[model samples]
Target: MSKLGESLRALRTRGFTPVAARSAARSFKGVLACKKGEISVKLTIYDWNFLSYPHIQVLERQDFLPELMPHVDVAGNLCYFAPGSVTLDRYNPATAILQCLDQATAILDRISLDPHYRVEDIQNEFPAHWEYGQLSLPWQVLLGEIKPNTIKASYFILEIGDKKQALISNTPGEATRLAGALGANFKPSHFQCWILRTKSLPAVPQKMPTTIKELFDWIKIWDHDLYGKVQNILSQRDYLKQSYMPFAIETPVGWLGFGFDLDRIRREAYSRDPKKYRQYLHMKGGSQGLFRMAIKEVSARFVHSRNLSYEDLQNKRVTVVGCGAIGSFVAQALVRLGAGTGERGILKIIDSDKLGPENLGRHALGFPSLFRHKTEALQEELLRQFPHGKIIGIASSAFEYKQLFDADLIIDATGEEAVSELLNGLRLARSSEVPVLHIWIRGNGEAVQALWTDSTGGACYRCLTIPDPNHHRKERFELLKNAPVLRTDGCRAFTPYAVSSPLHASALAIDMICSWLQGSPSPKFRTRSVEGADLYKLRNHDPSKLKSCPACDPT
Candidate 1:
């Protein structure tokens, strides 16, 4: 159990009555008083061990207190305060001392950045705290001290109209919204007690602290100036960076693009540092990355075109290679999605090998068709299902097709490394004239890689994947030479068909065909890895030069 937990139980071991402690807690509410029409709050002391005083600066640093006591009541017991004797009021008095202490303690956790802190260095060297006198003492700061008791105090300021309004919001969400509305910005530290906004603010949020390295500098600098008073930061720097730094959320990059009347972040920054603002002026504020563009276009298309029907895909010619797990699903999805269902349609099923009992689990062909060649069996099934749609069966490997007879879209659905290499070569060769859609299941059966390459636009598969020059260079070349005939053995025993592997490959094929038929953006190359979700384009690849690739390079 935690040390705090153990200490709390210790209080129970002592002879303290629940009623007496509760009464004492309740009686100490003299410090709390709300205006007649304002929100009512209460306070009650559950036990003596609950009382612990904190420092003001620390409280300011940890700005979570107001949420704990959202409203102050007329009674001694706070409606939102902690389970202890305490009260907070706008006024001060002797009897209200306990009330003040109670309310202050309750808000300490909300105020202080660190509950456990020691102050050191009272001299001019560390002057930030001199305003508080005998400054830089090691103690837990409280929220009440960091921020005055008045709710009206200016925690933030913004120019809403003709006047500059000082804003001391009760909540962070409100403060942020107000800051955005008034064309004001705030540093992270300024957010400690609600927020006090002004028309003038810093260029960057205050809490960001210029750089991540500032923490180290602060520790070293403070240590030298406040030698014996503060804790040594050297030992704790790593822990703080790892555990605490991330929790300090920075301001939103820029005000929301809601077209509000508030001044833009750049305009406000320009007033402070004209040169820096000029440099920043070139930095546009919008997400324009490839993925973002894809999402936006897709969404817009979906919204604009209300009648995109499956019937539109009727006369499309699709060539599907590799009748393995993915090949089966690809064929199934194509037909279902209206590729080869009726007249004027064609679906070519290609595989140079037969199906075995081992492939039954994933193959579309049934047990009755086992032992038969995969291409013939699938073609028979397709004919049975859609007698009018023309079905072509190529009982040979992809390389055997000296030229893909006139396919609107050629799909390579095989997941073999050898198959991928072969298709890469073919794709590079035909990229200029015929567009190829290559789909393959990754090794783990978790994801699939799909690439679309045409002679007109985007990079080909070779451009996406270039063999390493250091290792296995000769072996890769030899493999490429034997590619046409090597698939006679079919997939090796190690690469077996599974549910997920084929599903991913098939999904990618559908995406490829959709992009082709509708002129959608081409699929990216780095998306080939099963674990990679973030897509990236290969910039270093050159498909035009065959010197680097023996199989596809005509030169």
Candidate 2:
């Protein structure tokens, strides 16, 4: 007998009996008794090496109060272990299997008997219940706040692409625009959908409703407000006779949707189609079935801020004033944070430099961008990666464009003391409310520092520096034990730093941006130092204006 088989034998006393192999699947069927009584269990060795989890399932889906069970998928697979929650002992497969089975039964028992636990589990894992499995479609999602006071159903476009996947959208002209941007082909046909929103979760039930009758019944039982809204929308004469009726309902976790082909219900060939329905008495359904459209939310807002407590930059006008090593990372992070997605959202990159062979060693752009204008190449790269992102490149000096300063926020990643001073001079000259976030790496990737300043009055960029007769650049807080080494390749002098520094600098900048978005932008300046570095101590707190600074006065 194999080790897995021998292990199954040890559980015989607990009512496990070896089941004959059906195809490649090996399993032991057993019974586990809890406060809610006994439920059937099947433990299968999914991986002989025990590198992956064992497939544990509850076989008694119909019997033993299945309606109240939580964390059970459509196929009765028990979700006992969340990935990264526990690591399996690869050396001892027998003990690891035992531990997993013990936890599975314990979790199953707890949810089976405890109503409060079941409710919480069901609410937290709502999407699993609505799982569409292999048929899941690529759909655009927006968790854009739907005001509670707004009682009417909103208009949304459902487009089916050439590959037969669908996208749900509220953006005007989004279908054609997105299709072109994504390089996807689509037909002329599209569906109109009305998705009912709710701030509640569905109660644990005997499988997420596989039919239309059960869908309404399930919603009516758990979310009364949403149920009433659905009925009100259904009662409207304008919506009754549509040949194809597609609808959706939102739970707190995510959204699920489907469509009913009202014309197909009468056809015997289409009689068994899950999405076939008949409209009788307008609000009444003479024939009803279920076809689930599992939504995959790909909207910039959802991608960036789904389940996040703080706001994202989806609607913000952001400008990154450099395309050097640090700025490239910042621009990419900004895109992911939704900097250039919404109607008013615009992300502009400004730089005069061209991508050279030397810059590619540590910069985001590689061989493809060689000799291209930094701004134009970066713009192309960002757009290619996120086709929906709105980005503009100004291949010019930061000092030339007055419009560059007019943004919700500006980030300076030049890491040049001269540019910082120039920006500080600009800051002193203007009373604009827009804040400037400055981030840079210090001395051979030893540490990263970020400073956020605005007209609200605190430290400006010049405050961090003083005259350094010994050095070419102004001395700032003396961060390194040894001076940063200057490199020259038969050309102009520049500081040499690795890629990691700029990446860390980018992360620091994003953190500051997040803080600003969160509305309490404190600790305006922060520092993060790497280990084994020749570094001086640094403080992470808002700084007061330097009295000796010449640029702060702007005279």
Candidate 3:
């Protein structure tokens, strides 16, 4: 016997018996007859490969639990281990199997004794449980708010080219904004929907309710509030029709949908009396159809707030002074950080230069943008992918448009001395009206540095360039020994930084922006060195302002 097969022999004393498993080579299985107090469950250890988690399932086909059982699935599969949460000892396969068996039974024992834990566990993952219903749609997205008791729902049509996708949300106005962003003409949908949100969920069923009557029974037992509301709506006079009622439940996790049609259309011929209409709506036969649906949440609230931990730049007005290699990435990253995605948000780009074939090697834009103004091309490219951003492109100089400088934050990626000094003067000119973030590449991609200037008396952009006693404005803490060698293709000259330089600068800016949003943006300046670069000794501490310098220092 293999070392793992010998491990199975230990379970015999614990009422487990070995079983032949043709479940691929080097796999194992055994039926575990475990009894916790009065409750007994026969589970089988199915798949135990080095590649996957040990698949343990209840042995009897009829003993499978409901979808809402805590840590246990519909097929009686027990989830003992969360993937990537722990490192399994692949070296000791024998011990690993024994450990998994113990953990699986421990979960079973706890849920068997404590019913409240099972309720909370199911409610926490309610969306997943509700989706397993046989008649549910694949998924849905929302763009509207949901409140308890009231019914607010509608059907929307979204056309992405020739492919038309119909979906449901709470309001037509919010849905109109989302669908209109794709440049499609808006029209009302014929497929009407009704959404009823409830404060609590229904109790776990013996099996997922397949009939409308079974669902009503489950709701009556667990949720008195939802049951009361559903009763009042269905009891309305003369509103009874044979048409199917398509509706969704706005739960905490997400929306879950189910629909049922009335048999009155077929049965109405049997009865001409008004009292017979109520009798025709009864669900006595299995032929009374009941199916579930999916409500995919494509709403700004869910779509934008789901995965983010830090505050996104949703409603902030941001202006990019350059749309070159570094600024292109900065604009793209800012959009992803939720800039220009809110109702009052704005993302403006200003650059006088046009994109060339040579700029593509180190730029965020590509061949499609050749010869087009960099600001306009970046706007075109970004809007094609993320139409939610309110992007304005100006194919002109940043200095000429004085009103363009008005922003919540200005990102200067032009990397020019004249521009930095002018921006510093503007901060002083406007009494630090708005913060400016200047990010640039230095010494041929040796490092990328960024400085965030937000205070009136704090370190201005010119503080880094203040002249020393030797009459030369040098690095306060130098990291580079030699300057970047300027490269020329005979017509114009430019520094030949690699493609990775702007990306590094973008990463640095993103971290600084996070700190800025957190309201404690200390260590205002930051730098990152490229690995394996033959550079001088690094001096990367945050530098304060000079006391007697020219631009920012008091005279």
Candidate 4:
């Protein structure tokens, strides 16, 4: 006997009888019946493979109370497992099949007992079965370019008597002209219109509706009176004819065009119960029928880009002193985190050096940007990736940038003691201090550190470095206290480290900046390195603000 045959025999022992069976190598089909319900269940199992798991589905619909159970869709397909959760063990097909059957039976039994369960009971799994409204629109309508911010516009309805689909036009003039072209009988003034404005992109719905009433319920949750308002607007038009309400939803994924038709809904209600036709007519806000709405999803890149963090980052102005390895990565990371190119936030990159062949392996910019000034190249690269990001690249040293004093936050990635001292002096001299973050990699990428100081009088970058008579200025970390320096043939000595080391340092710097932006208390100094790899076995370090710092005047 085949493995399926043995499984069927086991199921029979558990009070399940096979009404019909099909034996094949490629697939298995059987009609099963159980004492749980008088309904005949057809199970079709596809062959197991790496790409597709071995799973069975009920082909024939069963008589079960709807909307009372989790994992069941409107089509009656029971979701045995969530996607990517687990793979079926083809070797243990019988055990897997029995386990699934047991689970399904338990779920059905629960539904039979409690058909009116709370919707919140299945909140976690609600999104898996959510059904979005059908929306259809022409490509040209969505392709039309508009401004970034919100704008008020009119939605013109184009539906006649009792039609299932309602056409809508965003262009009011085109809608009116089309009405005129149709002839004198079609009065352009009589057409339904809505005054709508672009709203911030909403999150993709987690819990969608399977029934029209469920759709209306979901809409009510978004705006309590919106359903009633939409109904009232539909009522103003001829009830006998198909009327449409314009719904333009800006979601994180894209723009969605939705149409709500009242006439078709009423017709559906009359079809479902002829005796309730009078009741349907007398119902307020057209709540008697299915609240089905059409949605047209348009693919737009920027739709999903605006959120709370993105909005906050948009309002910030940041300056990075060095557009080299660490600075370039930090700048790019900031842009990806919602720092836009213009009014949203300004990202000013300052560096006097040019991108050379030596920098390509460690730097964010590549061959295309070689020989170009580091700031300009990085800015151009960032703009190419994030078109909306407001980035300014200044090919000058941080000392020449006087606007740094006025910035919301300044970052120094120069890895130079002279530059840190200059910024420290400038910060102390100013009455209103701008927050500064200093990031650098130590001991040939074995260690990475980030120091942050804000207007609230935290330890400045100079405080983190003690005046060293032996080696000039040295980090407080014991590992770097007496570290040897490598000499090169030329004036410039190469720092031996991988690309990942600078990136790691950049991430730490970004974390500090984000914490300050969110109004959270962050550590003044932090460091991370691999233990016992290249230097000291210390894995992490977090130093407190210095009490005796000349730069911050901590007496």
**Which one wins on TM-score?**
2
RMSD of 1: 23.5
What TM-score number comes out for model 1?
A: 0.37
Report the number of the highest-lDDT candidate: 2
Candidate 1, residue 71: how far the Cα is off, in Å? 52
Q: Write the per-residue lDDT of candidate 3 for residues 1-555, one digit (tens) a residue.
A: 475655566555455655565554333345443454322344344444445666676544323323457666665667877886656676665677677778776776666657787778777776676765334443343335443454645666677677665567555665666676666555776555666776666566655777766777777886788877666655543234435556677765667777776455543443344334434444454236566665566654455556777677888999989898889999898887877777788899999999998889988999988999999899988777666678999988888886866789998888887887788777777675688888888889889888888764466777776476786777665667777799888898888878899999988887888788887555678778888876666544456777765766668
In terms of TM-score, which candidate is stronger, 2 or 4? 2
Model 1 lDDT tens row, 9-70: 43233221122343333221122122211122223333333343211111121233232121
Which of candidates 3 and 4 is the stronger one according to lDDT? 3
For every model shown, the clashing-pair count is: 44, 0, 14, 11
Models sorted by TM-score, best on top: 2, 3, 4, 1
Off by over 4 Å in 4: 1-26, 31-56, 67-77, 87-118, 121-224, 232-245, 248-257, 260-312, 341-344, 468-471, 481-491, 534-555
Model 2 misplaced regions, further than 4 Å: 1-26, 33-38, 48-50, 132-162, 180-182, 188-190, 203-207, 264-285, 468-476
Per-prediction TM-score:
0.37, 0.85, 0.79, 0.66
Which is better, 1 or 4, measured by TM-score? Answer: 4
lDDT of 2 by residue, 393-476 (tens): 999999999797779999999998789778867867776678898888888888999889898888888888765678655556
Total colliding residue pairs, candidate 4: 11
Clashing pairs in 2: none
